[model samples]
Target: MSSAPLSPVALFWRCCLWLILLLALPAQAQFTLGQRATDQAATPHVQARLVVQAPDGIAAGQPLTLGLLLTHQPQWHTYWKNAGDSGLPTELDWDVPPGLEAGEIAWPVPQQIRVGDLLNYGYEGQILLPVPMTVGPDFTPDADGTVRIGLHARWLVCRVECIPEDVQLQVQLPVAQSHGAFAAAFADAQARAPAVSSALTGQFEVAPDGQHVTLQVQGLPAPAQGQELAFYPEAADTFRHAAVLGRDWQQRWDGAVWHATLPLSDMRGATPAALEVVLGLPVAGSSVAEQPPAAAWRIAAPVQGQWQAAQLAEISPALAAALAANQANQTNPTTTAPPASGGSNARSGSWLMALAGGLIGGLLLNLMPCVFPVLAIKLLGFARHGSDMRAQRLGGLAYTLGTVVSFAALGALLLALRAAGEQLGWGFQLQNPMVIVALAVLFTVLGLNLAGVFEFGQMLPSGIASLHLRHPVADAFLSGVLAVAVASPCTAPFMGASLGFAVALPAAQALAIFAALGLGMALPYLLLSWAPGLLRWLPRPGPWMATFRCAMAFPMLATVVWLTWVLGQQTGVDGVAALLALLLALSALIWALTLQGRTRWLLGAVLAALLGWLLPTLAPYLRELPPQEASAASSAPGTALWQPWSPEQQTQLLAEGRPVFVDYTAAWCVTCQFNKRTTLSDPAVLQAFTLRGVQLLRADWTRQDPRITAALEQLGRSGVPVYVLLAPGKAPVVLTELIRPDDVLQALAGI
Candidate 1:
């Protein structure tokens, strides 16, 4: 028997023979769905099929995709959600089991079709429209292993002339398991479908002038400067889409956020509660390696107070007819300015100096490793459009605004939280477990994005773009946010005193100081923009930029490492493991996106299952704070020279007349980690500490510690990486937020 083992060729023939046998007996021997479960219609210009793509059928509680495959003849076309000046969106009438739920049709990006003087939006040749269907968890499969789903689909197929078509389509599937028959169709549909709007918030307001509406947006990826920013409304008569679609509107972008005024049509009709819009950055001839971004958003808005006189509440048909007849008599109200927030406070000279210091401190922070990576990317962004003065100055200003707003918001939050009685400081946000996880994820995504693993802005499937997001200023503002988020861990020289003073002052004063710091941080870029000649020093935009971007990703990756370590410190090894798993899932999804055809969908579903399985079991950890690090920090990490910092340990060391050097640090503190790796741990510096008999101790402040808090308060500081040097009988020497190698040596030598 061993000698008679089947050859590879023989095995292949045997498998083929079995498949042939299986196919031969399939008529009645194999299971099949009811006759009404599938349908197809054909015409000279098109062939439409309503097929249930599930080959293996659906399992209980599982969701599957149903596809409308429309194969149009050459030069024939189909309409999109908005058919522009003509045509209608495809419609499907669902008739499924009582327990099943069907979702709306997912639209692919449509091409702008123009015929003579009229413009239309639609697709040419073949296209697929997929609708999502789900089964209930409590559903029980029929004994026949079959489930029935039906659709009454209708559309107008066009080629010079339009022919309306209607057909009944149905699919019969086994309820035991999911199959792969429509895998390619589903993939194609999803590849072209619009993605859900991200977490950014936007608001639209009716201006006092009956002709205008202002829209403001916040959050989302920043568009490249001078990029095309636009919004396409889904509703036909809501705004003056015809008139205001082009030169009639005025838009100002403070980074990725927007402030836009749209002129209204002669008749606005009744204002709806909300408007659904497609926001995007239009692709340009000079696009980088990445595609432009487009998102679909439902913006909820209310009419501003100034427009009360013009807003209409439609009455009965008879009254509406009368009002419509008199519509010509209506007059447009005068325009008014927007309202302001917070009262005016006169600026004091002393306040100004403190603010200037904050600005300088923030600017200096750019040199810190914590902020360097993101800033590098931002600098590159600025340099890319250095030739355009309008873009350069606007980008710079928007970035400054982003920084100041973030800082002010942080300061406001801190003051509010402090006013509520809980003990908190400048870096208190890091103490929260959720914040830690969020920052880690953000850092990881940014690194991956920079490395070209995926595009941040082009989140939608092909064909979606934000007309408003194209203003490159969004990137500048977002850069400001990134800078502040990362730089929190490190306190630069001159920053500590300024911050300490600011935190102790009134809310307005504190916010002012924070603003000043942001302005200072943003000043260098502003100066470069103001002086266009400096832009000449930058390397021209080309392939090298991509390489440079990839290189910068590593530093961001390094930052993520530190953040992960910080998370471990705050949440323990188990929490770190959970977070890492989430990251792994995210990475898998990212990779899945790069694939095409059926493989992309099949793999995505599997990976999504894995992530879904993991989230419920580990989600609680996001809210779970770590146990105290008091005992954990006591153990020396790789080196015995440093000891855990504590009041008792410090008192004992000082009483023994042993000169002490304390490193007040945190895992999240980038400056602390930077100094530890570069300056403090230098061979000469370690040698100097050893020779001085200085007992070096580390005080970890990753978690909230009353003792550490007291230590910082006593020193008149409110942040970490505060190095203190003490001699047997001398006062403690408070080194600057940032220290030089010589500063350390001199402090040790004198103390």
Candidate 2:
């Protein structure tokens, strides 16, 4: 009774010693079921055990609950029945004696887990899947009056990476009247199971395009009427489980009925007569304190619309092969891991090749039309700084820093968004109408500044203008940033492979490749600034400099026009009109700022008001516009030489043994337009296609389309201007980004 209190340090050590002792004991030793029925199995991340709801013993002709309880380590989880995007559900193979039977497992409501751009439904922490077991009237026990239940259990557990584990376990119980020891555990499991709802009625309709499904459900309880709810289809391949539910797909409640429009999977293989789904909601005022509780209901709704049978059957052969290989890898884990040394060597080689390609592609980007205007401005800056050697060198370094940093930042953002489950790729920014509007305004302002319409310095405060003039390096750096913004839409040769590889690489390696691209683009300018001889070759700053600077404005104006056209393609004529009005108001505002005193204030105020009115008017057009069908704007008027590209059409064409040529292009891509007008429209090329019976298809990427993105990835590309020639039973022949008529003919000839 008089024992002294231990110090904090001593107490901590005592607890640690006890923990070590407990860890050393066998997994099954801790459980005491009084020989009713219990056995345990364990892995590095999970502990599995079998428990029955009969404490004393099983009685003849009585129904009992048997549970396979899985306790996961922190953050690791196991899948549910459907398994969502990627996973296999836990499987149990029971070895029951004669005159004994077990019913299907009663699966509990599952939680949503996101991995990169994929969504999965599973359970974390401890879960009990209860199975109803029945003892027949004729059941006989062993001489010792004990009944043995054998089970082979297999499950996949995942935190960041998945590990498949299995174990064999047997539990022995005496034949006697029994009540469950784990009454509370069994009760909790039963409470979590979804009940079949008799009150709820629903129906689903597939859109005519076969891309979306609209679901309508009525007769919701008062508590869940307007609250957020999640839909989990009981069957797979009904919709794209990986797609972000509320964002990519949409859900809303209108007091009377819950409505949801979800995108269908590209590789959908199901054409069910009715869709079985579970609607889940968070349990309010839940009594279970150990874990979060959810209430769910199961409903089977009849399908009202036709399925896209023809399109569903036309999945590309290459994509089908890839999917098959992926499934094989999941099923056979032995083939997943290669020899460590050989794996490292192969990875290193592949990484180096990607890096090199990024570098070369960046160098080639300088020759693209999109980059020309910015480079022209840099050239003028160089000519102006010809006499100052030190300033020139510093400016060059600053420009290089800006380019590299910009590329790195963009790459990081892209990776982060992807990890958060967004489907995007290179030139993804241009897909947004808002970004297009911003770029159009920027190019317009730059054009005005270069044409000597109004000086930027004059518009700013005197002190700020002085500081900017003192440091011309800032201007050079910004020029480099502008160059990247414009150049991103163009996919130069070699860039496609490198960027595609970068998306699949580790974060550090992908960023290294991005930095390499920036460095390559900056190298020539850095050399020009460093070498005095090269600087001397340029005309000295004089009247000719003014004329050259004015001429550079034409390219900038042309770029604005091109951007306007691109915006038109994405939105419509209304969007183009809004953009033009905004630009006109912005030009007038700048011109007003150059005036003096009261006149400046008056005209500037009117123009500012006009701009304010126009901006809000343009907001509606910024939303996702419905995709327009192929029009004359993309190809020559009234000419059917090129059909809109679709996976189904391509499959059908290839099946007919006809060679198919797919042109993956986008409206914002300068090189794609150039090639379209020249090489693609050439009469000789047209005649060759006609004679050889080559089917031409154009895949427009002017807006975000996941199908097109997936197809481009299959071709080892992440951006547009991807030319692919496919011959039946032959490997797809990929052409260079910039193709000549001869290149097209040669590719066709091979096919």
Candidate 3:
């Protein structure tokens, strides 16, 4: 018997399920800031106090202890010494009496707080941080001077959401000859504070190689197994919290001095003058409630001076120790570093490096998927002209020059936009729908042409072919231009670093880097031109060339299909239809250009031009369509297996004691698609996840998303596809940029 149609209730449930799957960003809004805690007469969720040790009234020309006390409301919490990804660090800015200088705050060890998927390093309940102050012998107590102190404090209070708070505190102590009750509390807080003499303190010195920064510290303690440490940079742009760490512990008479290999925060900026590194010894049965006593050390190091290949080894421990000590000595009783006035010339070196980077990057571009089709054509052209060895080589040289010149033009454009106050990046062009659509149409047309839909050689009117490639030099220049355009999507490995650096360099330097990239792209071709014998190795003119050319069309077609999907994502389904119409118009125009009769061809040209101009103009009007849902491959229930992408859903899954796996992917990335088809969607892997009760989440990166970009940045990655797995009550384990099923399983082993 046939089954009856679904009832209204069933239909409604299906629609709701679909809606929940489609709206993932609301679930991804894990980072929030607002007033989350209530302040009441019963007890405040947060409280601040300024404590100082002095006579009953306070005294001039005598030593004094300065301190701050922070208390949080029940169940709510405030930030710790090193607030993780989102919250602001607890900071205190103090103004004190003349002739009385305060020392740096002696911070106690802080607990790590977890809110959803993110981990913040801070505190939950009441905690006190103290500082010591001294009065100069020149001051007199009979003057009846009042020691006025002001503190500017900033902290973050969080419940489910986080809010940054700033407060101003004022306290006046009269110069007297006796002591107060609060002095004892200050003394007690001081004992809990980590000693300045024990923690690893140092200045970060950038290695000449630019790949590493060396930290030099004085009085560093010896390193043992399981030493937990964190580096806090005074400058926000100096060092990211996430990066591969390399630690070298040097044992000295006083303690072990740690020379950490910190990746520079921005290769475009100078290394920080000094970084406060707090290291803790793991204690038995210690939890967040019981933080291990932290060892405090300070190292003062200079960020300037050009150290070449010769200077790396000559760096002295004494110099590092002195720099650390100097930075520590100059600190105010406040823990915050003074605001930096301006950026230094560390960017100059970056530009020079960018130029070199571009050259290397360009050289690697020849092998990139985007440019491979163009390379085949160029290679075939060389083989056709092999008899004229010199000419063959000349042709290759011309192509190489073309690539370089075009890259220069692109670089200049990027630099110009930046100068105009635009926040553009390396792949910014790809973010524009118009650009993507245009490229899609162009690639589709090129694919059809290669497949023998029309012949460009026969279609051009008088002066057309000449305009396209009249002179060998012009042909070379045009080839270079086309080469760079084709190579846009396939970012060569080293080129990623080079391009990232170029984005932050000055205009001139950035352009130079691009020029270098062009040079790299054309280097091999130029070499073939300079020595024409290379073409002799290639097959002579034959039908195989035609076959190879036809085969190359497949890659171009694939590129077009990928771009079409990308266009769909950016402007939606209507935009995809518009792109298809544009492609059809392009094909008609190409045919018209090749037509024997002038009248017929003229009409095709006009129609083609009109379509090109009109379709894009109409694209913006198209409403975005929801993603097409495919039927499940297995009978597993959605609730028991795959959970649709949503930030709230993720939080819910974490709360349910389920391990969550997130895949941030894009349609444009061939690598991403391959992983989805071959690994992620594999039945074995799916079964493993199902058996383990894993909650799978997918974040589509086919479109430009600011939130995803920021998330990627937090992970120390600028691009995707990224796979992250978060187990209950632990830090998330990030898989490598490349995917491996075994690696994934290994990372999920214990969980």
Q: Give me the candidate number with maximum lDDT.
A: 2
lDDT of 3 by residue, 410-446 (tens): 7787668757865444455676665676566556656
Worst 10 residues of 3 by lDDT: 30-39
The models' CA-based lDDT, in order, is 0.64, 0.73, 0.56
Which parts of model 3 have CA positions greater than 4 angstroms off? 1-369, 387-389, 392-394, 401-426, 451-461, 491-524, 530-533, 542-555, 597-660, 688-694, 726-734
lDDT of 3 at 488: 57
- Show model 1 residue runs off by greater than 4 Å: 1-353, 456-458, 461-464, 467-471, 619-639, 648-659, 678-695, 727-729, 740-751
TM-score of each predicted structure versus truth: 0.49, 0.58, 0.46
Relative to the true structure, candidate 1 reaches a TM of 0.49
Best by TM-score: 2
Looking at model 1, how many pairs of residues clash? Answer: 22
Clashes of 2: 2
Deviation in angstroms for 402 in model 1? 0.5
Q: Give the Cα RMSD of candidate 3.
A: 22.0
What are the clash counts of all predictions, listed in order?
22, 2, 39
Q: Write the per-residue lDDT of candidate 2 for residues 1-751, one digit (tens) a residue.
A: 1122221112222323332432222122212211113478665577888888975467775667788999999999999888887778999889888768888889987888878877888889999988888888878887898888888788878877665666667888887858687788899888888778688999999988788988999887777788767778878666888665347788898777999888887657657799889887766654222233467778899988777643445556664554333222221211222213346775677678788888887898899887888888778778777689998898899889878878877888878887887667788899877678777877777777667777644664445435435556665676667667788777787787678778778999999988888888888999998988887779877789778877887999898998988888777777788778878987898899988899999999998877766565555544324333532244443247888787768876887789998888888887788788888889998899899998888887787766788887665467777787777765566677777899888867866
| lDDT at 237, model 1 | 49
Report lDDT (Cα) of residue 728, candidate 3. 64
Candidate 2 yields a Cα-based lDDT of 0.73
